[model samples]
Target: MCMAHKSCVSEADSAAAAAALFAWGANSYGQLGLGHKEDVLLPQRLSNFCEPGCIKSVTGGGGHSAAVTGRKAKPSSLLVAKNQGKTCALYITSIGSGNVDVILQRGSPWTAGVLIIISNIRRSSLLPPFMCLVCCILLLYDCPDGGSLFVCGLNKDGQLGLGHTEDVLCFTICKPLLGCPIRQVACGWDFTIMLTVSGSVFQWGTGLASSGRRLCAGQTLPLFLTAKEPSRVMGLEDSTAVCVVAGSDHSASLTDTGELYVWGRNKHGQLASLAAFLLLPQRIDARCFQDEKVTAVWSGWTHLVAQTETGKVFTWGRADYGQLGRRLESPEGQKPHKQDSQLTFWRPQSSVSLPLCCLTGAAKISCGSEHNLAVISDKCFSWGWNEHGMCGDGTESNVWTPSPVQALQSPSRILLVGCGAGHSLALCQLPALSEPCQDVKVIYTLQADTGNPESQNGMNKERNRKERQSVTSTQSNSDRTRNEGP
Candidate 1:
């Protein structure tokens, strides 16, 4: 996801640099040395995995799944596992004590929320792995239906669910979770939470979470703050979560039953309260949307946004630059509010109050460091800071009202859109499916306001927005009907 430069190594190349053909592993981290994170990697292309008779063996280890691909004309062995689903992943695989192949099973018409995690590679887990000394730590949760929610990075306090205190290098499959079938995973600084389809909750890590202890002394509520492994929450057995999102130090979970559960820091009212922080996952009420069920919820570094079935958007938390919608100013003075620069709130502010809230069925929203963007069908709408035009509203001015990007408004249908700390990008495809060679690619622009050479480049960044690139596809032969692997 680096934009400093444009270089990508294919998965095979990402392995040990196969064929040195500018493949994935060939330029791992794009010279940034961003080290390992998750999953198994072997020297093979995604095409080889799908090609008949192209794979010879597939190995499932303690926390990883790998395959040895064999090509017909020039067969070679390469351990492999192709991502079959579109979901977020936080993994780093190594061949150590873990040898559990991550599996996901579903029961009846209830689809499995297979949000799988393959390791607890805590803080020091990135020390580099040896060929024979690699280990894996993996966990699974149903995504969409009960999946996604991957947790990785530092866990020095046993916040990771590997059941041990040692930091992990590669993703080590958490063997204990194989039988539990997880629905989602949410991570706080040194803690993690897991949700199950049956409405069960399990948490791990230091702080009040490591012990799964509830502080009842000065507290009048149930606390599931600290634990070293996945522990079930006492009262959440009847709750079912449909969506989950995390901020830097706080977390939020929305249940199908029209309830919101929050925990962790709330210094700025990000958790909908005045309390400094919460050690337990407490159900916080949103007074503004009291009667409507939240359809989606998103968390920024210190802000929160929610949408209702009526296409209503509610925002709160740090609104320094109007991150909480167009509520930056007061009606009397028509200027930025008194708390606009310093105070933060957790209460939901109406989006309709803003001049651009009528999005005509706005369906989704994405947040950035201090900006926000939304999508309705093929068009995208943005608001907030325009210091570097992160709003993509065709100007470098701060905009509190949502407006569609004119540059990306036609000839093609939007396929995907993303927002980053300093830049924003969109993917589009020609609607002419009848044209076999239609191109689909990303359009990028600089949205960061860092006043440097790159910042100067931001002024001339318009040229890069029109750049188009196409990905290659694989063709199957008649003999490719049968494929085999270990």
Candidate 2:
């Protein structure tokens, strides 16, 4: 999400940009937020977020989904005051925060405001009066003003962070994170990882597996753990992490200084270490990265993807599904190994490089259990497992190489991309039209299965006008319904 500048667009205009939510694929546990537990073959709109700029960030896990949504505070001229010898403008703005509970059982979304605090501002006389700006400006914030975590779906392992092991039928707030602002959240098979703005890491649900585990070679140990409540993770005392990633059974973090730390299951060398499992965070060997500072890291069920400041990408771990995005050459420089084979323990799994031809110049990357998505400029490319049409290429065959998602190759700018166990999500900000109107057309594209994707739907000038009217009418009825309770 990008910040809005007043010079280019007003705050109210940004807030009213109509950034909608679209989801597809597996909904067995209603993880797609589509109001029912039916598998969608193509992208479908999740009706609740159609209102302008309501959704902040969205993510999904094995059988669940979560999103952070809220309104942003606008800079306003609180008053003009005198300071020292000159008259200085005293400005103040209340940072707005809220959350919406999507009760999948009922399927209607409702908004609930959270913590509202005063944000720091420099005194200025040029500040304008109070008014709502554009939806894009506020909804795109990395950390909304006091974000609230709303989660729903299978929580039998207490992965929802609601202080209980029972499954959540509605989107409920994580009790421990009530007033605290969250920076990021990552969901694993039966656990969840959270990163706060202060860089504190939290984990909940079942911990790393305990069977046949050892800290080092020949050291027998048995350890099992579970946290129904969110617990702060240790071992990252020396550095602050800027991002966090969670695979099916492993977790990772990238520090502000560019160091990479990984923990948990190493069944397929996902930890980049020889240890079978890591109970605490351990920095990956810099030598394996060619001494380059890692810029970003993403994970799948048993593989890891990383990008360096030099624009180089490296992948390791389970490659039988082509999730590595490139071939692994044999030690003898023989022919590239087959994708269905596993990496030998002797091979330097940490140093495997993603071929430049496979992927280059990607602005962002996301990984599902066995697939990947990359957005470069205006196009989104997908590869690996597509059994559920998660690759969005209108097919169920596994994609061994990067292929463009024709539906998303449009003038609309891609804002964010996310993946789940067998589904994919892409949030796009549609271009503004030349004519003036109260609302802008925002389309949500959820990639679930294979068929002609709805994104291919053609729109002429008159059709677009009618769709805009329909959106307006829907919003109007929504507003009236809110005012006139049934």
Model 2 ranges off by over 4 Å: 1-49, 52-55, 61-182, 204-206, 212-232, 330-345, 348-358, 430-486
State the lDDT at 163 in candidate 2. 73
Q: What are the candidates' C-alpha RMSDs?
A: 13.3, 14.5
What are the per-residue Cα lDDT tens digits for candidate 1 across 73-161? Answer: 23222212223442222222222222233432322112221222222222122212311111222333333333333233345666666
TM-score for candidate 2? 0.59
Candidate 1 — which residues are off by over 4 angstroms?
A: 1-152, 207-223, 330-356, 384-401, 419-425, 433-486
Q: Could you tell me every candidate's TM-score relative to the true structure?
A: 0.56, 0.59
| Candidate 1 Cα deviation (angstroms), residue 21 | 22
Q: Residue 23, candidate 2: how far off, in angstroms?
A: 4.7
- Lowest summed-lDDT stretch of 10 residues in model 2? 131-140
Reference-based lDDT, each prediction: 0.45, 0.57
Error of 1 at 49 (Å): 16
